[model samples]
Target: MDLERLYREDHTFFKVIVGDFNAKIGPRRTAEERHFGTHGVEWNEQGERLSKFIMTTHTIHGNSQFQKPSHLRWTWESPGGQFHLPDRRRCCSEVLHGIGPSSPPR
Candidate 1:
């Protein structure tokens, strides 16, 4: 489950395995879910850590250019033990791509 470490060890093989990755793969490209992974996006420490691992692995070890934030969150419907619920953005997976110090390199 330690995706970061996995990437760190094997990123050099990405080209051989999957070819040059474009780094545009992800969710949340809609108007409503646009801020899904933005700075203000809500997440616990574990979530943040996973996000950092994924992004860093892609950028540094994999030599890839990231577009959006590679983070995620569970919606209200996915909470309280109920699998489905009305009036909820169930799969709001859009993330914000930034260019600040926090952003991944180009």
Candidate 2:
């Protein structure tokens, strides 16, 4: 069976979806008051498609769920020195919401 078929059969078995989709997810706040802040985010064609898929499947953008600086957020730097985050991690809301940075030392 194809990966999608297997994935559907055992969705819980999936910890993450890893790949370089060359997709850009632009910033937006409160998707139906659900999604969080995405720094410098932009919605491209790929992002539109991904957003629709996320809405349908209740998937969360793993990277967006975190608080990272602009430099660390990108996966690639173009020859012209433009940075873009192409790699992505997709997981269900339950899994994504459960992750956050631990408290700092006093």
Candidate 2: tens digits of C-alpha lDDT, residues 1-106: 5534554677484557666666677666565624434663666787677666556555567756667776776655588987766554653345344345784543
Question: TM-score for model 2?
Answer: 0.52
Cα lDDT of model 1 by residue, 30-85, tens digit? 44433233333344555445445545544432222333354542233345665534
- Among all windows of 10 consecutive residues in model 1, the one with the lowest summed lDDT is 16-25
lDDT of 2: 0.60
Clashing pairs in 2: 26-41, 26-42, 27-41, 27-42
RMSD of each: 19.4, 13.2
**Candidate 1 overall lDDT versus native:** 0.43
Alpha carbon lDDT of each predicted model: 0.43, 0.60
